[model samples]
Target chain A: MAAFYSFMAVLALVFIAAIGAGSAGMYTLFGVAIPYVALLVFLAGFIYRIVYWAKSPVPFSIATTGGQQKSLPWIKNSPWDNPYTVTGTVIRMILEVVTFRSLFRNTKIDLRVDNVKVVYGSAKFLWLFALIFHMAFFTILIRHMRLFLDPVPACIQKIEFLDSILQVGIPTLYQTDLLILVGLTFLLLRRIVDVKVNYISLAQDYFPLFLLLGIAISGIYMRYFIKADVISIKELTMGLLSFKPALPEKALETTFFVHLFLVSCLLAYFPFSKLMHLAGVFLSPTRNLPNNTRRQHYTNPWNDPAIKPHSYAAYEDDFREKMIEAGLPVEKEA
Target chain B: MYHAKYIIPALLVFLAVVTFPFWAKGKAVYRVELKLPANQTECIEDTETMRTSHMQILDHWRDKVVREGERVYTNAKGVKYSMSLTNTCMSCHSDKEKFCDKCHNSVGVAPYCWNCHLTTPKGGK
Candidate 1:
């Protein structure tokens, strides 16, 4: 996996350089062809992983239960924490997925006042940051949908307008971009600054953060410095979408190539990376499986019929002679 | 207590796996191409009131030129100009056409650019 990752990283760097040099032919392959190929690979790899996991034998109910387990009404039970019924499980899953309840409940230990301090507090900042990062990234992606569509969607326009409502300057600064950048930086720093995290960190951990930072830096450069030829870029994009390869004269700019190149690298690297989690998260049985197995039975698909029965009657019949010899009591004794 | 030793290594492995994607890099390039007709197009009408078309404006701008006092800037309208040029070629054959298109369409391209923008910004429109 590391070898795979390293190889991908090298290729991404080459593409980055290619963009910086302002070559449109290479840019087209990177921007259009690679993205398409990556999408297909991503889908195939994603489906394979899901199917493989789904086919794995679970043998027993190993669902991680934290809420209240179902019990008799007369007895007190914890429903939210150890849900035993289907309804409880559904509610628990929702809270886990949407609210990140586990992360919200997280606690950190701090030794203060010469080790005498003992305080229990909620460590929900991680959850908040994660939510902010994901939400902002999602909003930014949706905002970019205008580029792909001929007549931009109303919702996208509204979102774009709302994102730049602060009206920082000409062309309007998108709040989500700033948020994502800040969030990414903070998250990366968190990994580096904390002693335990740093101790556990590998080159892989630093790579994504670095790659994202590279993307952000390039984007900022394009917006403020390079001033990419968006019109020509759009023409090429639309042409590609229409399956017509009409190369426009003087349509592309150096900065546009860089942006296109970075995006392509991201696409190609997606399937083989942790980024695949976007699809993997949905296929996770732990999250997707309903918790009503106690009420509903799931037959074991691996059962065979070679084993002999050892029922009480059979045992008695087989051991009757031995019992008579040893003078032990038996129901079928003469 | 027995699970503690293995847990540290397990956590380390998980973290490592999670970070692998960032390390992978791929090759990509940004290529730009300029497509022009085999024969050059120019706009050169001899009237004082001659106007150039939007297409001619692009031809002028493509070469990257600037003149005294008057300046043209990129704007949303400029984007429209670029798009329109993709379909029509005659919108930029002369001074009157270029000026009229710039004024009426709300975007402007250069007139002096026919010297280089096209092999023939002289005839056609």
Candidate 2:
């Protein structure tokens, strides 16, 4: 991961320099072509990983449980905490996915006080921040769908209309943009402020956050401060989507280029970066598979030439004489 | 029982990688109609009429475009609608550099809207 991140950082710097130099062609290939390829790589690689994990044989039952298992209903039971059955597991999974219950329950202690009480408050700020960042990022993403889709979906339009309903500025106030920035800031700040987290956190963590912050700030600058030519920008964007790369009469300005560059960097960085998590989520086996193996045994279907079954009969044939000599209970005496 | 409790959530989190792109929403575009009042159009004739009417329309356009959803009214034919600033603005200002400069200069807005396109027609001053 560190090596991968380092490579990305170097690549980002190089890409940024190319943009800074005003090489539109380079930017197009790096930002546009690379992103498309990355998406493909991410999709293919992610499915491959998930399928590999699913194919893996877990010969033993190894479910990580924090609470009691459902052995007998008449006996004391912790259904949600310790799910022994599939239905119970689904409930637990829901909580884990939606609320991040496990993260919420995490606790960390500090040595600030000599006789310090174990501070047992919810320590899911990271989880909360993650949830906020992801939701906001996707909200912004879905909202951006207006650029790619023709006759935009009513849901997206409704969301777009609602997002700026506050009518805060000259342009409508997109809460998602602000939310994403704020979320990214909090995430970055957390890594910086927490000594332990900071120590463990590599430049990979910092790089993406900074890169994202850069993208967000540049975008905001173009929208509110730099005042880009919306028509030209849209034209150029639409043209690119259509594969007819015509630079508008006054299609893009420096600010627009900067915004575009940052976005391109993000696109190029995605496949190799943790942002690949976008594709990684679906390929996960733990989330996709049903926990019904115990009810229905799952035998390995693959053919293998190497087979040595230590059946009870075989063991008896080998050791029954010794067992009988030692006067041990045996099904058949040798 | 053991498999259901822990393995699934971990698997879900692990598979989170797969969930994004299929549902990944792309760029969205919304079309809005900017209207020109009839009375305002009637009052303005050719270039001067376009210029004067455009300036009036611009004041309305700027505010609405910025505030978003806030409508601007001009007594063009004594009827109101979304401001038709684009048509009027582009009619004369089609030569982006010369016309855009006249207004942007006064407003003190060095907007970076012209970098990618030609400011003037192929050598036409």
Candidate 3:
């Protein structure tokens, strides 16, 4: 069902691109206007969501830990997993951001070979795929800077050169392209073949994967098969950047339109969907906060204060005679 | 109160953000205009093809000539010309500064082709 919905979504995008570009001949509108709209939605929605999250108060140091906590001086602390200090928390965040430490710590229980006892073991494929996928995507984005930046920056040029150093064919092949394809394939297959994953996976989950796969496939097709004119694409890109969007004639094909439209869809969907995890990961209290509940006190500012005793002046007023009778220390005589 | 405090401000912000596209559309009054090459009755390739794939063609020509020592280019129309930028292209379009630089500068591209090719007389800007 999930696959069906995702397939329909992809088909819808392709149909829209075909109809818009083929029948109506509005390549400029689809290429330029849609991207602009998507980017706007992405930025606005991201900021709005981040602001909303920031406005929500977190009164507890409820950082998740998979290991031991910091307690007595002699006790060992899992610094990265159960960060007690700000530095430890930052390190944990770095590990989480860079290596996905928590996912690396993922474990699953399965039946032993003897079939009598269950065994707990590591499940690392998803983590590995996710890490590689993110890294490859980031690299690909940076490498595309060559299109947007004329007399492209030295770093970007070097990255581009390094990416296609193998140069098996006419225009060199990038390793990231292969890696992303594999990563996305692994992710999709896991969702389809694994019963547990397939059972839990909604169409929402499959939609992004299928959509991303479509984007990647279309992009790969453009780079490898048709070989869209780079200069004209650059001109169009520069036009977009410089705020004067005129379509370069015959440079953008249906494949390019499909790639661009799908990317636009992803960008538009990013903020409103579960894909906000790209930003949400940072704001997560479980990941970002320090786990120092033993040393620090936390109070919920939203909760009301309890009833209290009378003021010192009032106490003095009420107990003045009693104090006079007892000759105890008193603030005032009433 | 809700209308004034919450809804109005949110609406104003959204309105402000969405206005950028209109502003961008409005402000681009002076776009890049390329001057046509002089003295050439027709180009090697069609106008559309040249507009799009000139960079790829030039790059291919550069590599083929420099690496393989091939110096002839046969266009789709079956006309042959020597693969020399200074001799062939500049022979017809003598004014690079006026023709090419207009489009390049408009798009913020600064190609290093002028570094090797003599665009101006020696020691002149």
The CA lDDT at A300 in model 1 is 50
State the C-alpha lDDT per candidate: 0.55, 0.58, 0.76
Please write out the lDDT profile of model 2 over residues A1-334, one tens digit for every residue. Answer: 5434744774565456456536554545543565456555655565455455455654544455566555555888676666657677678767766666666667776654566755545577778887777777777777665555444567777777677767665444578788888888888878778887877888777788877776677778776665665545555555556555555664355656655655656665665677765544433344433444556565543535487657998888899888988988998755
CA-only RMSD, every prediction? 12.8, 10.9, 8.3
Ranking by DockQ: 3, 2, 1
By lDDT, the best candidate is: 3
Task: Pick the winner on TM-score between candidates 2 and 3.
Answer: 3
Candidate 1 Cα outliers beyond 4 Å, as residue runs = A1-15, A19-25, A74-91, A110-121, A292-302, A305-334, B1-125
Tens digits of per-residue lDDT for model 2, B1-125: 22335446765664553343223424332222333433444433354444324434454566586678665455535555444434443443455544565443322223323433334444333
TM per candidate comes to: 0.62, 0.64, 0.72
Model 2 interface CAPRI class = incorrect
Q: Which ten residues in a row have the lowest lDDT in candidate 1 chain B?
A: B21-30
**Order of candidate numbers by TM-score, starting with the best:** 3, 2, 1
Which ranges of candidate 3 are over 4 A from the true structure? Answer: A113-116, A249-251, A305-334, B1-125
DockQ of each: 0.03, 0.06, 0.07
Evaluate candidate 1 and give its CAPRI docking class based on DockQ. incorrect
User: Which stretch of 10 consecutive residues in model 3 chain A shows the poorest summed lDDT?
Assistant: A300-309
How many backbone clashes can be found in candidate 3?
Answer: 0
Candidate 2's C-alpha runs over 4 A off are A1-61, A75-95, A111-121, A279-314, A324-332, B1-125
